[model samples]
Target: MLLALILALGGTMFLQKAFTPKLGLDLAGGTTVTLSPVTQTGQSPPEEILDRAVNIIRDRVNGTGISDAEVAKSGDNIIISIPGVGQSEAIKLVATTAELRFRQVLAMEATQVPQNLSTEAPTPGASPSAQPSSTAKPSSTARPSGRQSATTPSASPTGKALSSALTAPTPGATPEATQTGTGRDQTGQKQNNKGKNGTPTPAPSTPPTAPPNQDPNAGINTQGIDPAVLQQFQKLDCADPKNRGQGVQDDPNKQYAACESDGSAKYVLDVAKVVGTDIDTASAGVRQGTVEWIVQLDFKSKGAGEWSKLTTTAYNAQEPRNKVAVVLDGVVITAPNIISPIPGGRAEITGGFDQVTSTQLADQLKYGALPLKFQRSSIDTVSSTLGSDQLEGGLIAGIIGLGLVVLYSLLYYRGLGLVAVLSLVVASILTYTAVVVLGHNAGFRLSLPHIIGLVVSIGITADSFIVYFERIRDEMKEGRRTLRAAVEVAWVRARRTILIADAVMFIAAIVLYFLAVGGVAGFAFAMGLTTLIDIVVVFLFTKPFIALLARLKFFAKGHPLSGLDAERMSTEPARTTTPQEA
Candidate 1:
């Protein structure tokens, strides 16, 4: 089972190219800083307070999944290094003391419509005249005319005849020299009035107002509204579903909104309330009925009071209740006008959310809570050159260390050194496979420390071989009849000792892995992994292989190339008449 597991793990590492360890600062390349207590009135922060703050910052950092992040204390300050991740994101992560707020729009650009006309009013039935969709554009042929009608007695003879005579065109008129002595109509014919001098007199302009069809819905035709107002209208980007693209979301300055919707009613809206900061938590989830996604927020006590008050006012208004918006991290998550005062502190923001969007909101809100209010210390682009140099240096050291191990084993062990060599070969195979597989599965990298662990493990593998071989020699001196029998006896003792040693090594690796910080933890983990593999090769490939060799004449008859020669072994003398055959 053990051998199978080892082989499988190794194979997986080799075959898959998947590994995603949280990278260290050097490899990932990002900024680092120490944040000191911003003392006021020369008072320093208490050590305990600072430590608690660090813990919260650490949680936010680790949630990021970047490996080998260094968060430590230096004197009264905290040092944070963000490698291989965006500094802006990290800064945002820490900086948000989760100061949530809901601010009312006090005043908006004049182009934005007011509280009454958000365009969400249900169009009960379609009217061809109301066909201007929000996406519709103005057309030249659809121009409109404006007129004012009065309830007057044109029925009186003088009034009636005077209007007709003054307004009427002459019967045989070439062009009416019907120049009005007063401000009266050449009303119709004045459009083509005659003049003796023929100075080409222009038609008199009428008082300006919205033309019958030059509607606000045609949107701020410059003649209809101020040009500066038109510019403000264009800058609008309303995220509101009803007037979506009509104007920007609730501007802090928007006390009133004036919207020119496509064929929709022109309305002015008054913001009754501002969104409050202080939501306890925000989560995104599916709403009931249609399974639409929504952001659910639980407000802090004070914020709840503020929201309830706002809702109360909106609910009592003549219009339908529920107009409060829940803004998260700034974006309006959901802004449903209140139909009634929200009884409790819970708010569900239902826009057009999906499962993925809900999950994203939940995640953001989850980590967004922080212990410390962060101030960005510094930011700059990082260079990978230093990391490359370190990697090269680490590799060189590993090669040198491996070379020494090979040299020592070869010179001292002589013929038996081949077993050591073979064990190393197997260990390397196992170790390399594991590292590769771990890289794929867990995103591990081969740092200098990790390489050192592998190289050092070669000695551990060699030790197991020496222990087993020495055991075999001991058994032979004790009258074990054949090399194969002696091999079995040695294994019994060698196996127990190997197991004990491996247990110790594994425990140490785990303890160190958990306690140590930065690259040291990687070292501990790699060491533990290799130590287990070493045991596998010794028992499966090493012992069984030696057993097979003992059956061959070349090795059993003590060939010099065989590490297990008779001369190296202490053979027991014949015990004459020693024991009756049992």
Candidate 2:
């Protein structure tokens, strides 16, 4: 029965290990970021302060494109579990206080701005920092733009004629003269006046000279500015048509307009009146090598006509500027200089990008606005190397703990201790196999705490054996003639107490696991697993082993090592038993 029970438990554990998924910190790495309110007089912060802080922290985490992150309050402290956000950005995001503010760019030029520079700008709102330590490392500077140096990536390839962009070209000239020597015709043939291709019909090759005529629309007129540059920004407007103040006789607050240069010279853009929230849907995906994403922006009825007008103006421009900047969290992600006006308004951003970053951008834009700003309180990175060292230490401790338990139990309990030793061996096999299987199945990770729990449980296993042994001694004192009857009676009482003890532990563990945050959950889970293993060992291995021993002559006759004497069982004290008993 003992062997059968062991085999069954072992097999079941092995199967579970094979099929179950083990939990991982990264896969479900639940971390608690604790935010304590700044305490006056250096005591604990007040309840009201903590509550407000937690609310804001929760808001920031939810906005971060991380799924399943949670925040809750505990006695003057806020605990946040940034779950399912893997080890990388999880550390970066949580540690960031996200203390956003509209600090005016003050001066980008070597010259100072005039003090009266009031184009009434920007906005801000805040609750407080969401952590105990109010300190945060200063944010790193943004990567430098390449435009400051010629070596920097040339301002996103304009693809416009170089001459027009270098110095504005004329408003009038023959189409042939206006185009570059490398440009194409309606039939897609290269139109080179230099006779690089096509039939060189024959040129009398007149010498280049100053124009005799000052006609504004005349041939090869190289004058004041470029017509192509004028066409590029002719109708740019920042305010969406639908989003002007209540009734628009034109909002005096609209701050942006089409400029001679691309937005490079502009630092501030108009506040979005009709934000991304008005749009119904947006999604991002990767096709081939490019990151392709689309936004389906439908305007509020009031905004639609205005948006159409904005597009029409851009559409009717000399060169036609059709694209608007795709902005998010106050940063421009991409600006595709459209070749034609998009009255439809909805647009696509196509560039080389992997699937993940594209999806994250779309999610942020779709969410519109965040309710609260988060201040990252603390961030910690746990390395796999440390995890491995911890695992090794735990294993060594478990083995040592088990060896000590075995050495002492054998020296003290004699034959009774053997039962405990066997039960533990079986339990160890089951636990080890289950842990491995669970690693694969549930993504389970056995931290050092779990190993310690297993080692401590060795004492719990021994206690059960001691309880049964003591119960059997009581039965012997009550004058039981048969070993089997005494064994059976003792088991009934011992099983009850054993079960009750395990049940209480299991219940406590369950409650703690669900309620406690972070590392405490690991503690609770290990306790619960061990409590379960304890019960299995008792019901299947212990009881069956004791039952099988009852029928053995050595045990029935009361062997000395077994600490059993028939005389002890029989109250008359005649001592009818084996010589070992004497």
* Candidate whose TM-score is highest: 1
lDDT of each: 0.50, 0.45
TM-scores of the models, in the given order?
Answer: 0.50, 0.41
| Candidate 2 lDDT over residue span 238-310, tens digit each | 1232221111111213322221111222122232333444554445643222222322234445444444454
All candidates: CA RMSD (Å): 20.6, 18.5
- Per-residue error for 251 in candidate 2, Å, reads 24
Highest lDDT scorer? 1
Model 1 residue runs over 4 Å out of place are 1-23, 26-29, 33-46, 59-66, 74-77, 85-368, 383-390, 410-416, 439-445, 571-582
Compared with the true structure, model 1 gives a TM-score of 0.50
Model 1 lDDT vs. the true structure?
Answer: 0.50
